[model samples]
Target: MNANNIVDATTRSPARVDEVLDRFFSLSTTRAATLAPAYEALWKTLRSNTNGGKRFRPRMVMTAYEGLGGEDLAAAAHVGASFELLHTALIVHDDVIDRDFVRRGIPNVSGSYRDIAHTAGLSIPTAEHRGMSVAVIAGDLALTGAFRLMGLAETNSATRARLLNILDDAVFASAAGELIDVDFSLYSGVPSVEEIVDMERLKTAVYSFEAPLQAGAVLAGAPESVISALGKFGREIGIAYQIVDDLLGVFGDEHATGKTTIGDIREGKRTTLIAYASTRPEWSAISHLVGKSSLTPAEAQIVRTELEACGAKDFTERLAGEHADRAVAALADGNVPQRLVDELTPIVAAVLERVR
Candidate 1:
């Protein structure tokens, strides 16, 4: 298929995943209502949290499944939706860890609950605690909801088992990656570029890209060799995707990306961009500005200027392109089908499309 056809196909996959999620939420909402009104409110909040996502994980699953001529789209849909739920779970927990109250320019689950607590006349500290507690419970629900969706897949025993294994690996690797990421942020020493790259791969590549692609192949009953190839492709592109996202976090137009450009710099996120910048002389001038919760927009702008002049931005861009190239090379080396390859190659370009 051509690129347009591939885009159309992947676009349809989100609709399929949405169908599955709708059914799951419908049932959950009813059950929660039976439990208590507050329980029902949590489910409503969760359903809202899961909305407006890019649905990238589900698209990856469907891409591989359909590309390989998989017949069971229903099974694939359920599997794809599971990853989306997993994505939600991780981000919800991450917000709690970061103590971030906003997401996508609005109040997140924690923030919403905190606002509710405030309206209820709770003290600031108590409200904050309540928000965090509710958010933790909400994230747990999403995490378990992911596995529940997986179990709803229509596939037989053997295929279901394999898919579950892939999901398990994704979850395990992502949790480790998240822990290491938090550790890196807290540690005094600067992490190596290689280490950050590994962390990125583990945190995002496995679940967001690799597992979804691999699971789709398993659903299609693809050979082990092909599954391995797709996983590699997913890893390379996933890393590139994240690196570019880091770039966007610093330099891209917040209005265009719908994410804060200053948040990463303020949080002292140990990204590949920051890692490369730290080796430069300009870093000394701006190092103190980082991680300042009260960092002003003007100060953040200075940090951005230093990062650009120090060549960190250009170096990181080149690194992202190199990884994208490697992803293409994997397809060539692995003898992935021409149709599968053609569809997948465009995705590599799409990964870097934002920062450009």
Candidate 2:
């Protein structure tokens, strides 16, 4: 099979999942509308915020389900939709953690409320606090909404329970990872490369890759060995995915990523790149600028230059390639079908393709 065709066919943001999400949002807004107009507005804002994603997580579910020869596309669709909901919930809370008001270059739930508060004559600090408060509520709603979506899947109680457990694992691992990520910034010294890798794996790899793939396998009723192999592949690829994302966060086109490159630098996130850079003598040149909130574009440019000069970019690229290679190697497990291997192989390259 043409890997590109398979990818396009399998991963085009399934309309079925979108329909499920649409119905979910509609019912949610209707219930909220009955209570208060502000509640209705909150749901509407969340609905807006959750739109325009690539829906990769849901598609992963379908991919594994179909690949493993499972029928019941509708059941897979509901489970996949739940993963997407979980993704939205996490990112909404992540934005709040990052103190970001925008997502996909638009005003996020927090940003929308913050702007409204500001226009209503609230002080900037007050407006920001109000925005964060509303965003927290919005995030909470999305978090619970994810489990609710899972419960909607037309599957037996046993299978549904397993899926819920998988989702809970994703949520649990993600929270641990997010906390570690936050704590890294508070350290007086840069975290080790190993520590950074572990943090990245927990924060993004598990939920985005491992859980989705495993969920698909479980939904398909695959054997334990195949499920284990997919989890390994997903975990490795997910690490590479986040590494490339970190690369993009510092050096990529804002239009392509729909994110500001400088934000990571400003936040002083102890990414692998930063961790590696700290070991280099050149890092001292721009050390003071790494975490400065009011960092100027020119200053950011200087930091970028130092990072490049110190070979941090090159090192990070090599690290991502290593993980990608390991991800492909994971498919060699005898239990994994060759057809599945071929279709999934392209994803490793695809993960690193964005930074190139």
Candidate 3:
């Protein structure tokens, strides 16, 4: 596909991604009859997550594949589904850890189970346990399903092996990053800007961008130069994406973003903004309120006000812009087709706008 063709395909991002997911659902539905009833419920949760979002990871895969000269649309679709499934699993697991009961304005996987328990008149403790259990199982199912989908892609064995290797490393690195995130949250001292950037690259960038891009390039038989360039693009963009996400988590309106402004503050997420603010003398005034489970809107607004007052917000924006520039530079070095580059050009801007 030429770059113009790729641009045309971008317009169908939702329909194409959903079409890929629908095929998987059809097969899963047939298999559901042979599985335990609980498994079916979990599948429903997976379906919910799959149906929402812009399917950013899958878009990355398809765009990279087509950009690299792969022509088999069906092959791309199946591969796209695999990445989507992996992302869904990650979100489910993240929700479980954050104790978030809702996503996309609906009860999340765990929240669905919690609702069921609530309907059954279970106590809060029991309901919460049921919710957590279901979310864990649901996440596991999605994670395994992702690999299975990858295996089912219509590709050569050698190609699949390479893709799997890339994916496995991404998953491992992402997990290590997650563990570090938990540790960072528990520390009394604020994490440094460098540490925060490094953590975001590992925790949010790898599987989210790097693995999918590398896998796509590998499937397309692209050269190591292209694959390496895509890796750099993914890493830079992914960290930028995460940093913008952190900004939104604290400053964005819930109605517009579908994310709670107070959640990160309540969880004490170790974002660069918080780290920068910590260096300010005002840290002593609001440090205790950051991780408080009872963090109110008033308290969250105070943090936001201070984040802006301390110049952390601008610092974060500058950092994100710097990485975005690096991402574009990486793409420029890839010998990437102009049209392909054209298709990807908007991603950096879109990510920046996420803070709104």
Candidate 4:
């Protein structure tokens, strides 16, 4: 299929998934009438935060389901929505950890609360505390909502248990990875490429890719071999996704991405591209570009140029292609249905080619 067709398919998948999420959000209000005011605030915050995401995780779930020959689109969509809710929980907590104030062009949960506190004439430190408190509670609410949605999804007991197991494991692993990431940022020594990849896999790959695919496969009653094959495929794609994101942090259009360019460099994130560049002998220019309090647009451009010259961008792109090839090969070798392969092949291609 062409790129446009792939976009259309992916678009359709998210719309279906969002519809399910909307249903769940509406149902969440049934108890709002009887709940305490604080509980009502928590639920509303969770729902609002969950609604603003791009639904990438949910798309992954639905794509895997369709690829595995599952015809129950509604059930798949509901499962995808559950994943989205889980992802929202992760993001809300992650933003708190990162002390980020914005996401997708709006004040993040914490930032919104901070704004309200500031409007009420609170001291700056007190406002910050109020924001963080609300964010922490909102994150917990989102996490609980994720499990509730999963339990309410239509599926067999066996499938439900399997999916839950995968989801639970991914959540735990992701939390550990996030801790490692935060610790790494605070330390001085840089880790090896293998260690960096391990961090990426644990913090990102499994939950971002493998678990979603596995959940869909379980729902579809896919064979063990097929599920395993998809797992490998998802891991590779997930890593590439992170690499692309890292690249965008330095070079992408800020308007398109809804994030400040070079924020990763400012935050001192130890990404694969950074790891690779730092190991090279001619990395002085690149090294100086990162780990700064702020970066000027001209400086960011120069850093982007240096990154390209050092072959970091090319290397990342090549790695993404390698993973995409592996994903496609797995589908072919595992005898997965052709229609699913056709749907995913272009999606993988687009992911590798994405600029923002």
Candidate 5:
């Protein structure tokens, strides 16, 4: 399929996307209001954190629904909104774990709470502790809200149960992957590329792509074979998405990406690019640059250059393409409606091509 066809097929109506967001925030606000004022402060933090994301997970859910011959836009919107809620919950907790200060050009949940406390004249360490505490509870609330939304969706009980199961399992698997990621970070030992790929699949793929697609398909009353096929497709695209994200972390424009260029290296993330570069003797200088946080911009550039020189970037890009191809192929195998397949082709392509 051509790009325009793909764009038109998968591109959600702006009004529909807005409706999903409105429903989500309205639910979030109502649920949050029942809490104490301090907890409400955390709710506001959650709201801010979730406000400006690209809505990628929700969009994926809706696209999959459309791909499955689902014509009920309202139903698709509910499924999409559920995924977005779950995603926001995950992000709130993730930022706390990563101690990430910034997200989408704004202070993250924990950071925003910290700033609020600081402005109130709390001491630095005290403010940080309070903020993190609130963020943790707020994240829990968001997670609960995700389940509530799913329960309230206008779908049959069987479909609801299946989607909820998938969401729960994906969350557990993603958490396990995050733990492994933390373990890898703390240890000095380098993991093999194969190992890194495994980590990426669990940490990023299943939750970000597979679960959302499966849930959408289930909601559409798709056959089991079709749902399974979409899951396989989602796994491939999701992994590619992470690989591309890793590439962008090192090589993308900081202003657009809202991240420091090469921040992953400074943070010592064990991504596919790092794994590939470590295999090349010619890239030893780049290897030396990997774990150092004090690297100058020039040094960062040199390291990125070395990564390209060692063919890491090219290899990663090719890997993404292979996954995209696999996703397209899976679509063909599922006996999916032609219209749905047509929409998905470009979305898979866009996932591979996204700069941020």
Candidate 6:
């Protein structure tokens, strides 16, 4: 379970994961058709979205399981698929909340419905409603599918319960985090830097990284200490991932990320970057520019200039590095096998370097 071997294990999971997911979707297709023609159409788009994104979450589960010496890859793959489905469900709801029409360069769940409505010559307002409705239903469907998939994992009743409990906790935490995120944006004053980090952990860290690793560890019969240690490491790395994501939201090439560079600023999304910049006096002049749904390109550029001048960019980058260091140190402190350490190195790199 060295780094190379970890990579090898992960490399083999893609096809196996896809194979299981394909079956899952086929079942969905039949179920959706039974629901209605629109449901059938939604299932097709869900399948498309499933095929589009890289299955990193599930990979985390499988690698951790195999790294810990779990020989039952079939069961591991099922759990891995469950995590990916959970992600898919959440993202669909997320898009509805943000009114985001696209993800990874294509129409998101709501956006797909929006596109369909547009093709059918619906009015803008009607189309928007349709989009939101479809996305919500789609998200619910995916969430239920995720739960069912986890229930089917080839493990004992006790282990199955543990896995489901982990998934349930993660879903609860993620929902709370999303709610907090909305509330944070509505705060009268700028949130503290600590708030952003805390939100990052609750929102993105636990389920995306920690839950997957813990789920795998549990199935592999790893001790509670190992599971707890992996959880901490996931938290640190998850925070780093968010920091880099915030950076990319503002500065990375839209062509690469398939997101509008100005979206975060325009949406007035609260992030650590904003918290850091708010400490400076110059923030008052440009503060009004952010959060405007109709923000112009020139205004976005102006805001960007001020953010850079106030040193927020540099501060965010430095702080992200510190978090990455902490994550690595936590992994060491966990005293996990060297193989687990090696298995997780890319996750650390992805967060710190923002490559994947």
Candidate 3 structure, TM-score to reference: 0.91
Task: Give lDDT tens digits, candidate 6, residues 197-314.
Answer: 8888888888887899899899999988888888887778777878888887887677656667898888887888898988898799788987888999899889889888999888
Name the best candidate (by TM-score). 1
Candidate 2 residue pairs that clash: none
Of 3 and 5, the candidate ranking higher by lDDT:
3
Pick by lDDT: which candidate is best? Answer: 1
Tens-digit per-residue lDDT, 128-234, candidate 3: 88998888887888788888888877899998877777877877887888888878967778899999989888877999888888888888888888889889988
Quick one: RMSD of model 6? Answer: 3.4
TM-score of each: 0.95, 0.93, 0.91, 0.91, 0.91, 0.92
At residue 247, give the lDDT of candidate 3. Answer: 83
RMSD to the hidden true structure, all candidates: 2.9, 3.0, 3.7, 2.9, 3.2, 3.4
lDDT, each prediction:
0.87, 0.86, 0.80, 0.76, 0.76, 0.83
Put down candidate 1 lDDT per residue, 1-356, tens digits, no spaces. 01222244353457889999999988999999998999999999989999987787899999999999898888889999999999989998998998888887788889989989999999988897888899999999999999999988999899999898999999999999999999998976678788999999999889988999999999998888899889998999888888888898899877666668898888888999889988989989998987888999999999999999999999999999999998888888876889899788778767777676
Backbone clashes (count) for model 5: 0
Write model 5 residue lDDT over 1-356, tens digit each, in one string. 01221244367653575576677676667775787666565666677666755667777788778767788777777667677777777777878888876666677777787888899999989888877877788788778877776777777787878878988888887888888888888987677877877788887789878998888888888888888888888888777777777888888766655667767888878888887887888566777778798978888889888888889988888877887888888888987778777767777767766643
Q: How accurate is candidate 1 locally (lDDT)?
A: 0.87
Report residue 352 deviation for candidate 1 (angstroms).
1.8
What local lDDT does model 6 show for residue 200?
82
Q: Candidate 2, residues 238-354: lDDT per residue as tens digits?
A: 888888888988998887666788988987878889999999999889889999989999999999999999999999999999999888888887388877777687788677777
Clashes of 6: 0
- The superposed Cα distance between candidate 1 and the true structure at residue 141, in angstroms, equals 1.2
Once model 6 is optimally superposed onto the true structure by TM-score, how far is the C-alpha of residue 265 displaced, in angstroms? 1.6
The residue ranges of model 4 lying beyond 4 angstroms of the native Cα positions read 1-12
